[model samples]
Target: MAPESTNPRGDLTSEVLHALSKSDPISSTEAFPGVPFESIKAALDRLASRSMVTYEQVEREEALLEPEAEIIVSHGSHEARVFEAVRQAIDGLSIQDLENKIGDKTVTKVGQGKAFKEKWIKKDGAKLVALVDSINDVTRDQLKVIQETRTHDAKILADLKKRKLLKMQKVISFRISKGPKFALEMVKEETDLTAEMLASGAWKTATFKPYNFKALGADQHAGALHPLNKVRQEFRQIFFEMGFEEMPTNQFVESGFWNFDALFVPQQHPARDLQDTFYVSDPVKAGRPAPASADDKHDYEAYFQNVREVHENGKYGSIGYRYPWSEDESLRLVLRTHTTSVSAAMLQKLAGQRKDGRVPPARYFSIDRVFRNETLDATHLCEFHQVEGVIADYGLTLGGLMEFMEIFFGAMGVTDLRFKPAYNPYTEPSMEIFSHHKGLNKLIEIGNSGIFRPEMLEVCLSDYQISSMKIETGGRR
Candidate 1:
């Protein structure tokens, strides 16, 4: 009885280490015959990662016999078999008899033609007789040599491959050698030190894996500001370059008294409706405007009364909306619908007398978030930023305002501006600013600008001061 053969792969890694211990370098194919290439490669890789073994892949083409070539190796070549069967016959074998004897018509037919071409056989009145008494059977001999050696000359290999008797396959083997940390026994590597190792004093003798500092660490995916904020910063820089002070718009929540009434927006305006504005619910009522700090000496009561009177009745040489204005509506807390609200508060602060007994001309700008109760769309949002600017001085006119708008927009590479006459409740002769868009082949409205109406500025500035102010709003679009 034959003994059961053991699987070489069962202890491939240990076998490799043991082999490397005896030899400086060993061929995996010669050391581990009948083992799978993948299994040997996996074992070598495992040892290499631990720095216990190193190896180089050795690749070559090995000739493998096909079924026909294997059969020829076991038996003789097809043509040789045909010649032997014919020579063994007492009289000679007929074609049909030869086919029956060989049990393969294809081999018999092909061999018969080859034998006739080689003059090894001749036709004797429909009987096949051998013309030669002895035959070499070179094909069978060559295939046998290839079966033992797995290769021959390149020309012979090509011929054999063309004959479909053999095929060439890429065989990968490894040349393994002892690495720097070569060992017959694998030791457990410590990736990190623990308290237990320190307590036992085992760290001194423990083998720790070396760190690969060259390896790239995992991505952190750091944070960044939104595109709107980046653009806001750029606009702020431009405002600063133009001598405009940045208003503190951190107060997103504001009373209607500052957001609307001070801006000359009537209480009955469509913009004040629940569908158009976001009204805060908790602590719905807000206190009336008062001094921001002890140093603030602005008359908030007088400014508050002036706003109420302007909206309720005529004020500053113009008839007001003449509708019943509610103090509750004025003091209703809401998410500010515009940064213009901040502009309004700043303007009111300028109303107080300075050391010169007059309000100084000022340039102010704000870029911050605003909330609106509106249907969301690609071009519209419930909350977005507004870029607004205000300039107050004497002798400022519409022409100067247009020129300033050109220079402001030009600084940001916008040109060919066209202003269309429009109207706003707070700004007389309002203009909707548009710039020619070459891509759209038309003008697109980029912002709105106008001078503050006398009715609106009267409550915020002294009567003796005829101030002209231009508001550039919605430029963020």
Candidate 2:
């Protein structure tokens, strides 16, 4: 008959209990040197779960011999082998003859150099001859000692490691001790009470397992706003706190007139080219701009004529582009290239306030997506977000614009700003806003700001005899 199988974990648990009965504490490494570390930890965990025992983990680093060092320990050092081989031959041995005798070209070649360096061998013409009759292999002796003891002098260990003859490995063990519920034998315990146990009056004496309230429970995945939308919300809150109204920029498709002509952008501008703008196809064209509501009594026809005349010829004491502006081009529908198109429409409505009374000082802001025909790259994309703000009031100066920018950017923790002179089609004395970047160690352009020109405002506010108005606009991507 075959012998019965033994359970290592059960045997180890029982042995641990018996050992603990005699000693208050014991080390797993000293008691079970040959046992696997994982198995010992498992038995300890099982006993600890029942409050019968406890343990602490112990870690240490051990040095061991490499395959090459082991071979040297089993046989002899390379230099010693070469000396013995040469001495055994009455005459001398050639290079090929030495390799054939050793059956290893690498070992023969390395051994020959070491023997020569030690003055144990000399070159006798094309052959090698032994200079000594005997040798003691100190390398083999050191490796043998390390193989048995797992350690040696620090300098020798470092030298052996540098030569790729040894390596270090981490070893884990445990120190165990008895707990409050320590016992020689494990007793069966109930985890839950049943109806039969209750009816049999056994629930009163049942030893229920203790609940581990500290144990972590299952994770509950929750919904959250996207990172971009969260930032948009923060910008909106900032604008609201500054007494700015949000613009309706939900309309992605817009007529070219509101996008460019009313903004005083010429038809020959590079931004209107097919290479830069994404023109819509299905609708073919859009109707003339009209009132958004019947209550809005703004003159749509006269406003359209003023935009055409201003772009084609000089108007309101300004020299226009002098090119014949095409009405068909103005009506063509296209994807709005920037949120500035919405700002223009809002400004046009604000101009109509002149008919009711004096146009009030107003502030408007928008954070929305815009489309462009851009080459895809690390920094450029066809679709992206644009942040724009328009502030219109009487006697708003360039200094005021700069101060407003400081307060606005400072709210988001951005400071130390510098402005560079730039040119824009619709704004006079445009400035490119820049901020110092600590990471790049240079100034980077953050946005653009400028005051609106008379040519752009005249077409909208001309009906109320308002030739020009101070309107500041700032934008960033």
Candidate 3:
């Protein structure tokens, strides 16, 4: 009969310790006769956790036969069969005749190859003949021994494994022994004071478990912001310090109209191609912006029409790209390739303010994710972040844009600065900014700066001068 447990968990621990005390080193399978193996293992682990018992694992590699090896055992091995067929024939058989006798293409092919390699069979002109009058089929004999004994000679096993006839399997077993604190008899430790023991004045002698101050505690996993978000917060603080209001950039998907057409990007531009942008498929198109209300001061619909007209023909004293414009193409949905889409929307809002009254000098900034159809690599990704800023006032110039870059990057300790002439569809006289990296001992192009083109701002803020700059800060890999 099995021993009854007083406390199931405590009794299991006690039983393990008791078994170890008698045997010194015992297999876990032999310790608990009636208990499930998993249950015994769990109890052993609990004991190990408390340092009351220790265990060593033993692993044995045993050879097992696969289906092909089984066939070799039931029938003869391929090479052995070939040797037998050759020896029995008075005149050696030809390759064609040998294949007919074997009846298996695999056996004929593999058997002939191994037989020749071992020199067990040699060619007698066109006939295959046994090299010796009598031969031992070593592979067949070894496989038989392994099948019966469930073990193998190391060298024999290697050949069998190479031929894929034998598989080596690892079997793990455990040896458990009493640890330093192990004891046959156990006293359940009281974790707290009881009212009955206190009233009877027995609490004074109650046993308690010793405190293990050296034992490590469970890990506490706490939430943390992503590294990009941390840098974004720092950037937000910098923007606030520079007295720039944060622009809302919650929308990741934008209509092609605002993202491209409104920015004066021609419809035929390659940036709108499938290779360069990710377009939304389901609910594939977005509703056009509502036309300006007749009574409304902002006149958004009027602005939309004016933007379309400018793209299709000349406007604002400039000859536009004289090409057909499609409102359907403008309504197509896409993942915004840049945060400048947000800037475009904000500029339209600023235009509405201009319509209401005199335009106030304003500074806006954004830090957020943007997507592209880029092939991913060590330094480039399909999606990344952009730190974008725009300042709108009367008479802002390319010089004002340059000064802002110096002060902004300079505040972050980037003092060495150089600018080169560049171009953008929406920005005239664009300049690419580069900063000297002391560690790299070279200049790295950091960002792009330019004054907003008259064509882009004609409808939005024709009355105000605007300059914009965008700096692409690389994203997490």
Candidate 4:
């Protein structure tokens, strides 16, 4: 049938309103495929001169239509008989009505129910097409109307398929043409006339080629442990070889007594600022204090008294900085602010025991992750590991602590170290450890070492140490 001359889309001028909507625009040569290539090319040049449709060389994949969309393995003949049935029944008819009016095959299907199983259609039983079922084999013009009115998936695309609308057609076929230009006015063949053998099949090929790529191996491969981790492991070997027991990897989340107050960080200490420590997001039960029998009670009472005396009257031979300690501050749970808390608990375990009272000398070490808030960069990490060591014995000294640190570092092949006087609220006469990083050409402060203040030890462990050991890697900022 000839298309109507009274075009409903009106004019080319009107098409400009929907210029962007028009997909799969083909050049004149492609539009009239059966015509001689040059004649259609000349027509395209003429159309370009008058600007009917602009020509472009875009990557066709960028268009809305895709390659797989072109090859619909549709069922059923697109005969006008099927069209008439669908048109009359779709408005109010159900599947049974469709089957009765059309055929059982329309819904129950003649073969495997692959399309129906895909849920593209609903069936009352078998051999009936649903009123709402989508149809196939439409032209570009039919697709435009379907698109404007679509309330279902694949309908517009399927309609365009019915009309043989193509978003992209490879020109390789036209490139091998054997005819001259202006061979048009030739009768269009409705049926295949190539007389090609049915057994001829499609084939494809695969090959490899390189394009733009980026630098994938940018990180250095120098054989070295991660700087932070290397430090942590060095810690474990150092203290274990020094005869210190390993501290608990138990709950790294610690209460105020173990984290701050136990370590002599006063309730008012600015270091307890939220930005300096990570606090748990939720609240948890803090249990009742450990029970103290009369003997334990006397020991606890005695430790508290001595600690108070040291803080107020210089029991350690120096007047301690006095600040009120709050039990609430001791209750807050934080990332174990220091591995020293592990040692503090260990001491509490060993408190009140002499070699005669069945207590043995003990030292301990911890190599674990610690966290802090810091600006992130290649140089600064928000969380890193630390190496901590504590010694609990009858007679340990600051000189012994220094010798241990030097020996441990030396065994780890760390040669360059320096110690300078520093301060920790929990330690007395503290010294900060520094290392020389030859690559950076600067003296890097490595860690801290100090004698734990007697008052701090008494609160955490409530045991008066004849001497205390405090060594830490990754200093508190």
Q: Which candidate's lDDT is highest? A: 1
Instruction: Tell me the TM-score of model 1.
Output: 0.56
Give lDDT tens digits, candidate 3, residues 197-256: 889998888876667688788887767887888877777787799889999998999999
Task: Give candidate 1's error at residue 37 in angstroms.
Answer: 35
Candidate 4 per-residue lDDT over residues 1-477, each given as its tens digit:
112233233233223213323433332223232444444334444333333444443221111333322222233322323444544654444545545665546333322243344333444444334443354533333434433443223555555445444242333211112123222222222233233423452111222122226526678879887765665666666677778788875677877656765566666677678877777767742433453365553254454445445544444455655655445555677776667777776676676554454346677887777766666897777776677878766677888888978987788676688889988987887999888889889888878899888777655444454667778876221
- Give per-residue CA lDDT, model 1, range 424-458, as digits (tens): 88898789999999998999888888989887887
Models ranked on TM-score: 1, 2, 3, 4
Error of 2 at 340 (Å): 1.0
What stretches of model 3 exceed 4 Å from their correct place? 1-206, 209-225, 291-297, 355-357, 464-477
**Pairs clashing within candidate 1:** none
TM-score of each: 0.56, 0.54, 0.54, 0.46
User: How far is 298's C-alpha from truth in model 2 (Å)?
Assistant: 1.4
Q: Model 3 Cα displacement at 439 (Å)?
A: 1.2
For candidate 1, the per-residue lDDT at 345 reads 81
Q: Which residue runs of candidate 2 sit more than 4 Å off their true CA positions?
A: 1-217, 220-222, 463-477
lDDT of 1: 0.85
In terms of TM-score, the best-performing candidate is: 1
Query: Which regions of candidate 1 fall more than 4 Å away from where they truly are?
Result: 1-209, 212-224, 463-466, 473-476
Per-residue lDDT over 354-436 for candidate 2, one digit per residue giving the tens place of the 0 to 100 score: 63666766789998888899999988889888778888776777888889889987887778989988887788868888989
Rate residue 431 of model 2 by lDDT: 86
What are the lDDT scores of the predictions, listed in order?
Answer: 0.85, 0.81, 0.80, 0.55
